[model samples]
Target: MSSSRRLTTVGFDADDTLWQNERFFRITERHFAELLSDHADHDHLSERLLEAEKRNLRLYGFGVKGFTLSMIETAIEVTEGRVPARTIELILQAGRDMLSHPVETLPGVRETLERIAGTHTILLITKGDLFDQERKLAQSGLGELFDGVEIVSDKTRTTYERIFAQHGDGAARAMMVGNSLKSDVVPAIDAGGWGVHVPHELTWVLEHVEPPTEHPRFLAIDHLGELSAIVEAIG
Candidate 1:
């Protein structure tokens, strides 16, 4: 813990932390690579898409819609605007499939949230399209468990500071739990909040970053089930 005051508020990242998210994107990316094989090689198309996504992160932010748009742009670029209409249709279908996919909550997420809700103020602080994220929350059946939900354009130190300030007094008594080091853990720690990194199996490359090992409040746990114990220990 960074402060003497015990953690009073906990913020959870939605995708890949509480539920299965990146896997769907990965699957769709593979499907996309296959669809564009005539235009470019699988590896080349994959790299181009990733580059496009990164370049458009500012304009598009993070979400399935942004990803879908990036895929379209990448297709056009890689094929020199010669991508077949049928192939474009398949890409759009893949995006719709991702949007409509079932929300699969990760193991122990609901149970852990249920346990901790009794003691702390919980918030779902995730970044993505507002309607899409809200829909996912409704589908996840975990929306009622949170004190509030924030759908933001991006996750950064300033974002965490603002969220904690609004939800409570400051990050002094808050802890952020999520799977992305860049978006969840690092920025939370930078904002003076404790950060717990719960690693996911398939993480997006843009969200990848080295863990802050020397930080006093940084904790890495394999599973979210261990969060209750950490909260208790912090108290």
Candidate 2:
């Protein structure tokens, strides 16, 4: 226990933290890599795609659509603007498939969220492409569980500060739960709020970062189900 004051509100991350999101993108990328093998080595294509994504993050921000566009551009560049129509179709289909697919909430997420709903003011705080995130949230059926929902372009230190200021008037009484150390935990801590880290099995490389030292306000758990007990114990 870091503080004697109980948490009054809980903030949760949407993608990967509460639902299965990244795995779908990873599968699509693997297929894209296979398609490019004839034109370029897998390693080379992957590196190029990664570089494109890095650049696109600044220009396009995060989402499957931007990723699909990046793949299309990479294919054109790799094949000298002679990429076959079918290959281009495949890239486009990947993005469409992601949008059409039903959002799959992780096991125990709904149960845990439902369990804690009455005890805390739950807010869904996620950052990404607005349309994509909204679509997923609508389909997930978990949107109704939240008191508030935020779709941010980026999760920076300032973003967290603003979030807390807006939602967590009593900074000492707020908590954030999520999978990314960079976007979720670090910024939450910096903004003077407690952070509960629920790590996912396949964290994206770009989102990876070191954890903070053992602090009263920092707690890590294996799954969302553990949240109830952890909150009860701390409070």
Candidate 3:
């Protein structure tokens, strides 16, 4: 935590950290529920969509397209193919809209990035479906702020180790900032880097995990903007 030993390379998580992502999917799912209301129970349809998403994560991975396909499959199953062609069109359109939608950075994201960019080698490290993450980074317009952008399929201790090695940085000189404790913090600390947890209000349940206590390298903040102070303190 010494200023001289402060982090030089900063790693960031993408979804729910740099931008508003998950909420949009949640809103679209509600619209999808409305579309199938006449054909199936709302709760039942929601459950089906969730189930399909879980199954498809293993098959197709995560993204808007997979979710759209899940909705279509759910419709076909629940309605016994009674779903009209127009309804299917609406579902597809919803997915397209989600993909094409403008990226909205969370409060303080741009300012914070701009403030920290000059002092650190900023790298965007995110895990998800490949194309979806690429499209999102293109839409964000803040891609230039990062020194590098990585779209990873998974986040684990080994993944961070690989990333740090690829960046040619010692683990002690690397720092990770993210919203998910499970995906972002644990592996980062385990890999011998500093972990900063910036909890988002709408975190997905699957991404939730308790942080380890008595760790000298683990820092937690309620807001993204608080990072500047911590970095400055460490520096």
Candidate 4:
């Protein structure tokens, strides 16, 4: 860790960190399972859909399009190619609905970002399909708060290092705040930046990981409201 880690750059994860995201997925997933209820049980359908999503991540990356495709794939697999065309159309519509769904910024997101915007360089570092991510950011109305907005294919140690260095001082002088311990917290900590986790009510299974309870650079908060105090204390 940098001895002079004064928190120059602040990076926030999108999706469930800044606003609601996973909940929408869960909603659509339920609808998907219902559509396939005749063919498979809910648990079996959910398991298969998750497996498909994990497998197709490399090919399709992360976004509604990829998820819808995975759901369609799962439906076909479960029904042995007997899934109705009407069901497929409904699945496609569900994805479209998600794409157009309203963005709901989490509590204290705007206030905290505004409180720090003038004091420190802030960047939005998120990974997903560029279009959907951009749509959500634009809809969230927090776009102007960010000094830089990076939509990457994925989040990793190198990604954090490169982004923090480019957008602010460097990884050592930066802090990442978000909901996912895997993508938002651990990678930033690994790159020698402070990781402040603001856990959300709901999160995707793939994004869950063991918390870094023993890391000196890691801090976990219950909400975004506490972030300003943490930053001030660090300063």
Q: Could you give candidate 1's per-residue lDDT for residues 59-121 as a string of tens digits?
A: 988899999999999999998999999988999999999889999999999999999888888
Pairwise lDDT winner, candidates 2 and 4: 4
lDDT per residue (tens digit) for residues 111-183 in model 4: 9999988788899999888999999999888999899999999999999999998988889999999999999
Prediction 1 global C-alpha lDDT: 0.92
Task: Specify the highest-lDDT model's number.
Answer: 4
Off by over 4 Å in 2: 1-5
Give the C-alpha miss distance for residue 113 in model 4, angstroms: 0.3
Q: How many backbone clashes does candidate 2 have?
A: 0
Instruction: Give me the overall lDDT of model 2.
Output: 0.85
True-vs-predicted CA distance for residue 179, candidate 1, Å: 0.4
**lDDT (10s digit) by residue, model 3, range 139-191:** 88889998888888778899888887787376677889999999899899999
Alpha-carbon error at 30 in model 2, in Å? 1.3
Q: Where is model 4 more than 4 Å wrong at Cα?
A: 1-5
By TM-score, the better pick of 1 and 3 is: 1
* Candidate 4 worst ten-residue window by lDDT: 1-10
